[model samples]
Target: MGATVEVEGLTKSFGSQNIWRDVTLTLPPGEITALLGPSGTGKSVFLKTVMGLLNPEEGSVKIDGVDIVSATDRETQELRKRFGVLFQDGALFGSMSIYDNVAFPLHEHTDLSASEIKRKVGEKLELVGLTGTETKLPGEVSGGMRKRVGLARSLVLDPDIILCDEPDSGLDPVRTAYIAQLLVDVNTETDATILVVTHDTNLARTLPDNLGMLFRRELVMFGPREAMLTTDEPAVTQFIHGSPVGPIGMSEEKDATPHHLLGAMDHLKLGDVPPQIQPSEGMGERAGAVRHAERLRTTPDIEELVIRQPDKELERRPVTRPAAYSAPMRGLRQVGSLFALALDVIVNIFRRPFQWRETLEQFWFIASVSILPAALVAVPFGAVIALQLGTLTVQIGAQSFTGAASVLAVIQQASPIVTALAIAGAGGAAICADLGARTIREEIDAMKVLGVSPVQRLVVPRVLATMLVAVLLNGMVSVVGVIGGYVFNVLVQDGTPGAYLASFTALAQIEDLIVGEIKAVIFGFIAGVVAAYRGLNPSAGPKGVGDAVNQSVVITFLLLFFMNFVITTLYLQVIPAKGA
Candidate 1:
């Protein structure tokens, strides 16, 4: 049997912007409930809180007598297995095939064999009417198809409770109706408790056994469908009927004047309320309906169990000036988060079940994909340095010393910095974009729900691979830079080839090479961590991924310069130079 979720006095806020507060509700077991709210009313936030993805400032969410908010990490993970969530965008991993995406939860959370997994996946896909497109990637499918695939994945685990966050979003009415029917069929077959968050009036009116609505940062009402549909409450009527004439206004609140001018001036014609849609003919009675009838038999008046808690009135207050430490506080929080993420990567690195295949893929991309750009930057930089030094030595009648100066500078400074810039611009940007897209699409959240640590599966391998590649790339750049300097000194400046070759090592010691390699490793580690952090914590949409990539590049550059200065200063003071 499915579990009942009980929430009491739930409150959430971001700084001074309170999303919602003092919210209380109970989701009956084995029934479908619909939560209706306008845009920005925090319906999605409520879903996320229930899923334990976001922690609320106050309140408790209990499932099977365990409080999710206060549960230990292990307990929370175990509890999450009982839930199946379909995000608005479908949240499929773009890189995986449809078949693999559906099989992900089973592969991660179950001990089933490959054949068993295939059978279960095939069953769920057929259940969702997606039997044949198994080889297609998410990007190859339409919006409606992706949503169906998400539904299939969610059901693959046979979860006890299902949460659909705007499943009807971005779909036409016909497609929406099809999806609604699918939800009904799934619930009837499995008898799992389902909660759908949407603003579609048709869905709000017909799909659920119970209805709830949020407006102006408050849940105006939550009760059985007949009770809510028959109520004369201004906000509930205006919202469920899709009417513009009541408490709902253009600004998402009631208008001050009784008669206010506005667009879409349609009234809530009570007589026009459509009857609820029923399951298709020949479909047996829903398991939920059977459970509901059983409950009614035990207690004759079920309406008394409906919750209609009164809304708490908040006091109006004058706006106060913003705190001066807000910006610093935000900065400190980001720094702490990044540090914690890096520590997680370290802890998970040595754990059993290593991701060797993913690590190799990352290594190939970081070490090989960046070769051309590294060469391009290194060659030009070497020629420029050689030309300047050659000109200066000619004036001083020390032309042979140009080789020593060029080689030492290239080894001690140019190769490491140039390689870091190439990797940060090329490989680092790619990592950020890849991870950012996954974040915005909800793939990261899906992985977490399936008991997979993105740190272990994605971040650690990339970070280690980048660091290893940076050291190798530094060697390549150093070789190319020295050869470029040799050609520039001998062919263009008429310097003696013998002197150039013999004096190259006069000032460039083995310690200089070691310092450059060390710097490359440090820079690569910083860039990898910064890119991963920015990508994984993206804001919301496509624009958020772009913003994350931009920030990753900028922050990496700043950190590289500062770290280089500190390392160079310490090296000069602690390790004496061999030659002038």
Candidate 2:
């Protein structure tokens, strides 16, 4: 049975900018509701808030009586199991084949056998008219086909509530009509509470059993479809009629427009109410259909509009989740959260059946990217250090000890720092971008919906890989650096090869090499954690992902330098310098 979703007093914002406020509505169980709004009125944000993927500033979203705002992670995950969302672009796993994409939830949440899963996948494919297309990837399909695949995947869960965000976004009119019918047929079959966020007026007018519109950040009207179509509210009339002369101006996307343009946002009217699309022949009526029809007959024509004046009591109600944290505490909070995530990663490292394969894959990838860069940098870096040291030693008439000075500098500092820079610049940036893309696509949300721990599943393996690659690359840099320094000193500085090799052992100890490896490990941990932290919480879109990647590199470099300083200070204090 479809679950009832009750949203009350919902408010959302980003920084100081409010997206919407006081959003209250009820999605009657086993009914199809289409929410109409201008292009940038936070329709997608509303879907995220409803799913608990994004927290609302002040509200309660009770799904089958579980208040999503206050629900624990586990509770939220379980609640999400009852939900299936089709994002604007379908949000299909681009890498996975259509079959695998549809089967992803089953793989995550169920213990079903392979043959059984295959059969179910086939049935869903057939249901969406996509049976033979199973082997094809999402990228290989047409836009309409991809939307159908997303629909099939969403339906596979037999969820109690379904959310489709812009199902007709890129489709032509003919395909859009097919999609509309597909959705109606789906509702008839599953009887799930469904919310469709769209801007298609034809869709808005005909498809939904219930109709609603969001304008100026509030739900302007919501009720029986007839009531909305017949209402004379300027905004409602303007939207349903799909006219340009409405309050939704260029400022529809922005906060303020010129005062002179305010009157330009004038008027439109709702024309004749077209015949509402009904459940198709041979498709049994939805559970809510009879009740909705009964309401139309019994209720007044003015419509029981969901819009309301601000309730003073509800206005004073506490928001379990604030729109934004105070600026002063945000930095401290981020640092604390990073520490907590570090601890979590450390603890998860020892958890049984560790992600050895993923860790190894990441290790190979990071090592491949970092090794050449570290080696190339180490050669010149080592040469520069040895040349400077040899010249200083000659000036002091202590050329014999120049090898010791150069080797110690390279082994104890240059090698690990170079390795850290390589890992962070090349490897860390990629990690941040990958995770940020996943975060923005709601793939992480999908994992959580299937009761998977993203940190444990994704972050842990990637972090371990960074550490392991650091250790490996540290050795590579150390060897290359020492050889580069020795060659540069003996060949370029007019020094004896025997003296240069012998002086290395004259003053350096095993502890110096060990300390360098230690730094590499800690630096790798810092880089990985910082990258993952930012990636997990990117701002909003592709731009957010790019921003996160850049931030990861900057943050990793700063932390590496600071950590290098602390480690160097501690190492010098704990272990005295070796004697010549």
Candidate 3:
């Protein structure tokens, strides 16, 4: 049997835009409830809030006496195991195959053997009628197939509560009916408490045993399916019957026209209420229906029991303008939050159960992909320094100092700065884009729901890998830079090769190389952290991802230049070299 979800006095908003307020509902055990609402009514937001993905401002969501809203991270994680969420658009990791995506939760959260995981995944896939398509990626599949994959993934964990957000979206009528039947079959077999947020009138009219509607920022009614079906409430009737003559207007608000009122009455006079579609005959009685049967045997008339209760009245208040300090305060809070996230990563980076595979992959990507750009920048920078310094030294008749000047600049500044820029520009942007995509797709949330820390699984590995590759790439850039200087001095400037090589190490100290390496490592860490932060907390949608990537690049550049100044100053003061 599934657990009940009780939401009381729940309020949520994004800045000044209130999505819903004082929302109260009870999802009974083993019953399927459909939350119906027009677009922009916050149905999806309500689902996310119930799943603990977004915290309501002033209320509690309790499941089995545990208030998830105020629960600690560990407690909330445990609670999330009982939830199976099918996000709109599937939200599957684009990189993974269908089988791997479905099996991700089990692999991350359980110690099941490979064979067991395979069997369970195969079984769930078969249950969703997605057998033999396990090798396809999410991008390769049709929208309906992706939704089925999402459904299969959600069910693989045998969750107590299944939350589906617009499961029928972007599907044909036949596919929608097939998915509806699949939901019914799953509910019958598992008896999971299912809450589906949808706008499909057909699905809302037929699939769920109970129905609730959200309109004008509040839940209008919630009760047995029969009670809703038999109601003459203007909004509910207009919505369920797909009529345009009642409360819902073109702008999704109550119509204010007397003509609209007359049209609604005329439509009502036609007596055109459609019959509720019954469950298929051969499926036998659903477990949910059986559970309801036991309740009905004692209550006798559950529909009337629900109808007599007053609809929840939400007290509307004037929307208050935000305080003058709200923007600055929000910025400060974000800074603090990012600092804490970085601190968490540092504290847990050395903990046991390392993500070695992900770390290796990141290392390979950074080291290989970033090499050419680093070299390209370093070589030109070194040649320019050599050309200018050689000309100046010759004019002053101190040609021998050309080697020392070029070598020192390449080792102390050019190599580290160039490699850092390359890594931040190339490697850092890649990290940001990847994490941003994952964030937008809700894959990061899925990982959290599966009790996986994205910091450990993704961020730490990338940070460490970038740092490690930065140090190595610095060395490569340094060598190529020195060679570029050598070529410029000996060939282009007509400088003596013997003097160039001889004076190269004359004033260049070992301390310079050490400081350069340190700077490269530090810059790489800063780049990785900034990129991960921007990526993991993107605003929303494709535009958000683009903005995050831009912010990461800009932030990384600022931090790199500022930190370079600080580190360079410290090295110069500490070291006793001639040009440090």
Clash pairs detected, candidate 1: none
Model 2 lDDT tens row, 489-534: 8788778999888888877899998988888899889989999999
Cα lDDT computed for each candidate against the true fold: 0.84, 0.84, 0.84
Q: Alpha-carbon error at 392 in model 1, in Å?
A: 3.4
Comparing candidate 2 with candidate 3, which one achieves the higher TM-score? Answer: 3
Q: Write the per-residue lDDT of candidate 3 for residues 341-370, one digit (tens) a residue.
A: 789789779876898998999999988779
Q: What TM-score, computed on C-alpha atoms, does each candidate reach?
A: 0.91, 0.91, 0.92
Off by over 4 Å in 1: 253-287, 293-304, 309-312, 315-325
Model 2 regions lying over 4 Å from their true place: 253-272, 297-302, 305-326, 351-353
Question: Candidate 1, residues 511-568: lDDT per residue as tens digits?
Answer: 8889999998898888889999999988878899999999998999899889988999
- In Å, residue 527's CA in model 3 sits off its true spot by 0.9
Candidate 2's error at 508, in angstroms?
2.0
